[model samples]
Target: MRFQWLLIIPFFCLLTACSSSQVHWRDISSNAVQASAAEEPLSLCRELYKDEAQIYQCEVEMSALLRARQQCEKDTDPSYCVLMAEYTWRHYKDHVLEDSPDIKQAGNYPVMCGYKENQITPCSLTK
Candidate 1:
C-alpha cells in the first residue's frame, strides 16, 4: 500500500506538469487573441464600420487571427501556435458575437497561415 502511494505521487506530478503547460499555452493564445483583436486592422475595421453594415467581419477576424498566430509562434512551437491561434480566435469570436446567430457560420479563410486567394489579404486557416 505504501509503495502504491509512491507510484501515485509521480502520476499526480505528471498530471500537474501537463496541466500547467496547457494552462500556459492557453494563456498565451488567449492574450494574443485579445490583444490582436483590439489592435491595428481589427480596431480600424471596427471604427470604419461602426454600424456593421458590411461583411468586413471576416477580413477583420482573419487579420486578428494571423496576428495572434504570429505572436503565439514567437512564444511557442509553430504548429502548436496555429492550433492555439485558431482555438483562441474561435473563443473570442464566439463570445464577442454571442447573440448573432449568423456569426456561427465559418468564414472563408486559408487552410494554413499563408494567404490563398490574394497576397494583399489576411491569412486564414479554412481554405
Candidate 2:
C-alpha cells in the first residue's frame, strides 16, 4: 500500500509539472513596450515573438495599424476611427503576446478582424 501511494504521488507531481505554462498577455506586452523606443512603430511589436513567422506577423499587423491610423486622420469621424484603430492595435498586441490555446469559438464576435472605413463589417452572420 505504501509503495502504491508513493507511485501515485509521483504521478501527480509529474502531471502538475506537465501543465500549461503560458504567460499572461499583459506582462508580455508590458515587457515588449519597455524594450522598444518611442520613435519606432515596429519596435513595439518586435519582442512579441522570436520565430521568423511570428515576427513577420507582428510587422504585418503593425503596418496595418499604422495605415489605419493614417486613414483615421482623414476620416469624417476622425475621433471614432482613431479610437477603433487603437482598440484593434491592442487586440492584435494581445494576440501576439498571449501565445496560448486557440481563442476563436463558434458564434463569437470577430475581434481579431479589422474594420473598414471606420466601420466594423460582417454585421450579418455567415455560413
Candidate 3:
C-alpha cells in the first residue's frame, strides 16, 4: 500500500506538470486570428499612403495602436487601444482630407484607415 501511494503521487504530479505545459487550443486560435487581423490595418495604411514619409508614420502609428489594443484586450482595459484607434482613425481621415480631398470625398478614408468600431481590426482578415 505504501509503494502504491508513492507511485500515485508521482503520477499525479507528472500529470499536473504535463497539463500545465500543454497549450490551450482556444488561446492558440485566438492569437492567430488577432495577429491576422492586426496585420490588416497596417497593410491597408501602407497601401493607402504612397508617400514614403506618410507610409512610415502610418506604420509606426498603426503598430503602436495595435500593440495597445492587444494589451487592452489582455488587461480587459479598453481605454488605451480604443483611444489610440480613434485617434489613429481621425488622424488618417484628416490627413487624407487635407492631402487627397478626392479620396475623402469618395469615402475612401475609412476603407484606407482599416479600423472597425474604433478598433484596429486586421483589414486582411476582414472581408
Candidate 4:
C-alpha cells in the first residue's frame, strides 16, 4: 500500500509539472514577437477602438484564430500553427487597422521581428 501511494505521488507531480509548463497561444505569440516594435503590438490597439459589437467580433475572431493555431500545433502540425498565426496578424492589420490610415501605414512599414530599435521602414524593405 505504501509503495503504491509513493508511485501515485510521483505520477501526480509529473502531471502537475506538465500542466504548468504547457504554453498558451498568447504566450507563444508574445514570444514570437517578443522584440517586435510593430504597430499594434500583440493586437493591443484593438481595445482602444472597440465598440461593444466590435469588441465582441474582435474577441471571437481572435480567440478562434488563436485556438485553431494552438490546436493545430497540438495535433503535431507546426506548419498549420505558423499559417494561422500569420493569418491572424494580417487580419488585424488589414481589417481592424484599415480605418486608421496611420496605423495601416505603420504596419506597412517594416519592423524587426526579434529586436527593438530595429523597426524602421527601410530596415524592413526587401529588394
TM-score for candidate 2:
0.34
Model 3 scores a C-alpha lDDT of 0.46
Give the C-alpha miss distance for residue 105 in model 2, angstroms: 29
Q: Could you say which candidate leads in lDDT? A: 2
Q: What digit string (tens of lDDT, one per residue) describes model 4 on residues 1-127? A: 7799989999999899765532233434543333234453335425432455444344333443343443344333345444544554556557766452232343342221212223322222312
TM-score winner, 1 or 2: 2
State the local distance difference test value for candidate 1.
0.46
- lDDT per model, in order? 0.46, 0.48, 0.46, 0.42
Off by over 4 Å in 3: 1-41, 84-127
User: Which residue segments of model 2 deviate by more than 4 Å?
Assistant: 1-37, 79-127
- Best-performing candidate as measured by TM-score: 2
Model 4 residue runs over 4 Å out of place are: 1-48, 81-127
Q: Cα miss at 30, model 1 (Å)? A: 23
lDDT of 3 by residue, 1-127 (tens): 7889988999999889765522222223334345446636546554445676655555544544444455445322355434544455556646745553232232222322233355545433334
Superposition TM-score, candidate 3 onto the true structure: 0.33
Clashing pairs in 4: none
- Any residue pairs clashing in model 1, and if so which? 110-124, 110-126, 110-127
Candidate 2, residue 101: lDDT? 20
